[model samples]
Target: MTMFSTIRLRAAAVLASFALALSGCFLSPGKFTSELVFTGPDSFTFSYEGEIFFLGLSKLAQMDAAQAEFTPPECYNQETYESQECSAEELADARANWESGAADRAAEAKKKAEQMAAMMGGIDPSDPKAAEELVKRLKRQKGWERVVHKGDGVFDVSYRVTGTMGHDFMFPLIEGFPATNPFVQTFVRQGGQVRINAPGFATQNPEQAGMGAMMGIGSLAGLAAMRAELDGQGDAMPGIPVIDGTFTVRTTRGMRVLANNTDEGPEPNNTGEALTWRITTRTAQAPTALIALIP
Candidate 1:
């Protein structure tokens, strides 16, 4: 449900991370309630019941058709490093150059989209039945309990995934879709430790932000370059639906919750403690935690 700078429609895919700026983009969240509950050191249950927005099927993909008013290119002095007024001839040349490349850019964008479509279960975004095909694919999967195409790349659905933490895990993972940046994650570590980070659910996660900086993806707007386009709650992008929800992490007693950003920290439950994050459009830091699981 998001992308990158100026979002050259050609490269955006969920049909764009498993919705990265690359070919396998991940879906953006709409309104919903989700939770991650840890019953034991080696097991967990994660469920997402809400709306997921697909970029290829949304107004975003049509951005190419929305041409902007051309602005005269500025001329700068190379030697003195100062701004200079452009000659009428220079302006004409610039306009001519940009106009000449419009068709090429549009074509490249379409080709990129088609390439993405091939990996996205082979259903073209241009096809009227694309959304229905997507629904069928999700229905055929194991965790996608319900999927309803609401048109324009949006779907109302319920998804639940559970498994032992012997290995890493990702959510909203389709049968044939290549894995990109996931909406949620649970990674098992060396000493019965587990990590939880949901970049898609948040505007930005602190650790990933630092990593993004190191990787040259400096958008504080979120996890990757594409997240800036989605902006989690869609504050930066107005047309997209609001991303509002709750992520509750419940763990068994004695499980050490080492790190988190919950408003009041973890709360007590019958067997253990509960950590809750009240996600909103303005959620600056993505929800995260490091818990050393109890054996």
Candidate 2:
């Protein structure tokens, strides 16, 4: 019974949590080139030129509902570990557990949806108007040079920012969004240590991506089933974009990189050292670097 109660939406969580785990739940990158440069310990410049994909209205509108609804685990399945030859009492107990959990699931879903709505200007990405509002909201910000909706929740845009690393930094820091899951995260630690990660760039690694790699979809059948289970139909939704891009980081001399996953590591650049990662649908880990500056 302990295991049965927690199995709600196990396989489906992969698809649903793909974007949901992103925490932002609104925007993720499709294809782009992003870069971060440190002129000095307290100074930096960052830019991203690429596509921002919206998965809520376009690819995963049923995610919340899918998460909320529990499909009964079939016992005696050959492929899955969920079920086996069950006695009548076990079956009855499972049914009772399922029935009891329904109200809990519904309540949790409602609470989560409400919290997301509060953060997102009272609108979730599943709404058609979300795309327009996103563009407008981004345009109102100083860094967003272009914000054009290309249909199906994809946007073509350019962004650039220059600031001091005296404090931490993050990209796609929407005014009304969650801060925990920035596409780009920069943390300034004590003793001039700096850490960075591009959570949105990695497309296909399970460690980084909850769904298909990063935010890339793994299976249409899975999507259809989750959607059908929640939206009452299993038809596939189209126009899901691929993820492809390059990320580069340049640091001035005297900076020592502590950890990273770049080909050939950090190569000598005009300013100092540079790290680069090419992103694709097969790309699993995004760009990450921890550097110690001359203090």
Candidate 3:
């Protein structure tokens, strides 16, 4: 597999794990509320407040184990997986088995850790310090300043990125793995306004894109089932994992939205100042939701 394909496969595995963990639950992973307040033509205050639900204690343990087992290769560590001399076959195998291997390895590690914990009289799930090490690991990133356990399988985290917006700002929801799953909610600035470009997942790989199109068609079929279930026209189909979120943009005082591709969220106010794009279900759509603003 090519480097890009490897990256895409890695991302798919992580997302698949997330979906399984959040399946059948009302809370899907976590809710993110972010604000991008433009301070100048080229600068902004990026604040994000969110929580990531672990679902169960075992899930947390599994995540820790998976992270330990899957340390990125030296080439990946240097952000040059494509150019490095790493064995392509090794990378291909890793990608092929990442999902199942992650689960199996995590289960084995969890079993061993459980045995040790039993001998040590077990660790309290409610112990704040239990998650401290993981929090520290997460905070090692440049913009992540705070990551705290907020009780009940939830983690309260916040981060800020401040500077002139370069070509684009990418916030990797999952990093350190083969594919850094960065979510780019903001686009290149164009004369006092920012554009919302296509999401990376939509174009990560041609094969994946084609697969996504097929999945989208499947989702439409699922949607029909959902409507039928609501109307008592048919039985409910298996649920598709739907990742949902909202992106809010606040331009400088005098700026306003110029154009948008989505009508899911409220339109720019009469003052033409701000807009929010609500991503209801980011399963297989193009993933590109554009919005341009201008002063």
Candidate 4:
């Protein structure tokens, strides 16, 4: 499939994963809040915070209990092909191999546990309270050094990125979507300044402009069919709680704000060295957001 088609498939996979994880608790379309702060010429901080209300506290408790009892099976713990689909004979072979490597696997697991304990400030996994501690840690945001749970299902998370922007800006997506896509434009750094452009909803592109601009009429028709399927499937799903949030961008010191298309929040401020752009919206099945930053 084409890059855009792959991205759409990955988006669908993400939605499917979310649905499975929160199957007990319905989720409504929710808001997604994000913030991008430029700290220096080659450094920036990104934060995304949002909330999804559960039907009741019981759902949250159930989720916590499920995670607390979670453990990797031998197939996952071992570095063997047992994790993959196998024939009956192959499965027997893998089981035998795993049994033979039990000692080595135990050593690896112990080493990994030690590392985890060190990172977690000496919290021993063997302790009775370890499961609870792990549950708390898992509930925190991923990829963020600091994550604050603001109660009522809200969370605030932030992470800093330094050095080159390059392709590092795009985090790994679900299966099918490659890290590189036309929608993600590469940033070029010049002197002390860097410019990046993110496509907006109304942005014009030859591939998506019209049927005449498409590679072929079949491609255009296929895209339409896929979109229709997605819409129908979305409508069929149970209505879940929605989340609404805002995203803001603030330029760092010594950096001049160039141009941005994001809407202003309650207090608009765009006429200074440090400008802000705010976008507030509801989340979707395959959500996509874009922004342009030149510093």
Name the top TM-score candidate: 1
Per-residue lDDT, model 4, residue 294, is 46
Once superposed on the true structure, which residue ranges of model 4 sit more than 4 Å away at CA?
1-29, 51-142, 145-168, 171-186, 196-236, 239-243, 263-295
lDDT of 2: 0.67
* 257-287 per-residue lDDT for model 3 (tens digits): 5565545543445433455655443333333
lDDT of 3 at 151: 59
* Candidate 2 Cα misplacement greater than 4 A, ranges: 1-26, 62-116, 124-128, 203-237
CA lDDT of 63 in candidate 3? 44
lDDT of 4 by residue, 1-295 (tens): 0012333453343233332322221211124455556555566666544432221121222222232332322222134423343455655665666567667656654664454344344556445555445336544535545444434333344443343444345421212212322211225454454444422101112233432232221121222233334556663222222223454555544455444444432233352233233322211112232223343
Candidate 3 deviant stretches above 4 angstroms: 1-29, 53-132, 150-154, 173-175, 189-193, 197-245, 253-256, 262-272, 279-295
Clashes of each: 11, 6, 0, 12
Q: Alpha-carbon error at 196 in model 2, in Å?
A: 1.4
User: Comparing 2 and 4 by TM-score, which wins?
Assistant: 2
Better of 3 and 4 by lDDT: 3
